[model samples]
Target: MINSVLMLLIASALSSSALAKSCPEVLDSTQRKLNAVEQVNLCDEFQGKVLLVVNTASQCGFTGQFEQLEQLHKKYQDQGFAVVGFPSNDFNQDRGSEEKTAKVCYLDFGVTFPMMARSSIKGAKANPVFTEIARQSGVVPRWNFYKYVIDREGNVVGTFASSTSPVSQDITSVIENNL
Candidate 1:
């Protein structure tokens, strides 16, 4: 019985490893939650979903976009859509701590989407996800709240500038068309 159990465990481990390897390399990245403690594998969590990714700052002029973003998440979530927010301090406008950023986003704006921990979102210091986003879209974020629309296949389909509102037809149309 002990020998049988050992073989079963070994097979289970190998099966898990193979399952993990099936996730594509593009979305195979771990990101910290807004609280800065828990981390999640993006591919494991969001591989098959259409994603609207935004680099956001609490104190920036574009901060109000969070409400519209939340609305988008609510409206399209059941249709395999998600809004992923990345809080960034690269613009010197973020609250400087996860707690305060959480308050601004979760409390003030009622943002229910997944918000990643604060990180640099520009230049060489940008996170690997943003790097690949820029590479695919040919448009790097010029300021806080610039958005990248990613399709279900993990393709960066569009990049919207900071001036674009989250609920604008230009943004939502692309999201609907992709969905």
Candidate 2:
């Protein structure tokens, strides 16, 4: 009986560890803030929510979309949805420094959604999240503010180009359907 109990306890422990490791490796990585010391562990923090991941640049023509994105975040956030921004200089449009990027995003744009550190969003140097996103959507970001819509299960269900408005019906429909 003692040996059986010990075996059961070992199995239970192993199963728990396995469950914890079940999140997709592509989504399990940690993302740092653009200016702050804050970090977000993607899988641990946002596993069950619909994610709208956008590659952003402070000086891009689409910069005004930040306000619309924030509005979308607020509209659906209470229903298990979130918007994540990744500041990138892949197009040389950003402020060129984390501090300035933070200022543009947080202060100038009044963005309240999470903004990730500067990362390459295209080609081989792209961040893992973007790489996986592109892989799933078959669409590499053509410019800043490219949006990838991910479902609650971490699957990329749609890729919206820079021209697609954040408040467009297509985006909200996808988010609502996922929710």
Candidate 3:
């Protein structure tokens, strides 16, 4: 009986170690949904999916990209792809409050993809997800709507400027190739 118990413990430790190694550091974060109490762990929610991560602002010129982003998300979601938005006021363009931000994203733009609560996207205070993304991609958000495309394994495969359209060939190509 003692030998059997020891073997069970060894198997459990090995399983946990394998799980920890498979989850990328970039996805090792839990974030609240915009204006919602529920939180999602990135690894648990998005592991093995191709992800388009964008830092967004409600009042920015690129806010309209939310529409195309939603389209992208819908088009590829069944194929293990997703578009995740992080609303930010770091550039002073986001709505004044989370309520307003949620309105703009859900009511105005009809954003169906996951949108995280407002957070810092640049400098020292950037959230853990973005900080790790920037570290892995060697790029940072210069303005609202900057995007990073991550592969299923959580490696940043592409970095896009705020000017790039969500449906642009450049962005779509990377997503398609990775997916």
Candidate 4:
């Protein structure tokens, strides 16, 4: 009887441990500020799908990535991929409020994907998600438009430098494989 009880207890503990899911090695928290951008639940946003989280700016040199990002979203959105854009003034690359920034993204790039609140994307005050992405991928952005690819299972699959174009074969291949 004692052995049976112990076995049952062990089994229960093991199952509980196995059921606890971990988020991607990148971006940390689901709770964060939502100002100009839409307030989003990361878990719900990417549930059962691959997500491309990019730190964006309105005035930065890499801003053109936004156009390519839109194209990627258009290409893969129907196939289980999403591009989550987070505007940041962390590097002073973004210069306006969320609505103000959205105007620029809309008029300049015609973005259709989700836009997130403005937050610091680097250093001590960086958004939890971006911080975790930097830690997991080991490729912190040197500038804006740095892209982090989250696999369908929510793992940090790759980190592209700010200069890495969204249309590059490397990024497209990942999208192709996952989608």
Give the whole-model CA lDDT for all candidates, comma-separated: 0.90, 0.89, 0.95, 0.78
TM-score-wise, the better of 1 and 2 is 2
From the highest TM-score down, the ranking of the candidates is 3, 2, 1, 4
Task: Put down candidate 4 lDDT per residue, 60-140, tens digits, no spaces.
Answer: 888878889999899889999989888888787688666678787887789888777788777898778877777777777
Candidate 4 Cα lDDT to native:
0.78
Global Cα RMSD, each model: 5.5, 2.6, 3.1, 3.3
**lDDT order of candidates, top first:** 3, 1, 2, 4
User: Model 2, which residues run further than 4 Å from truth?
Assistant: 1-21
| lDDT per residue as tens, model 3, 38-150 | 99998899999999999999999999999999999999999999999999999999958899999999999999999999999989999998999999988999999999999
Among all windows of ten consecutive residues in candidate 4, which has the lowest summed lDDT?
31-40
Clashing pairs in 3: none
Tell me which residue pairs clash in candidate 1.
none
The number of the candidate with the highest TM-score is 3
Of the two candidates 1 and 4, the one with more favorable lDDT, higher being better, is 1
User: Candidate 4 at residue 30, lDDT?
Assistant: 64
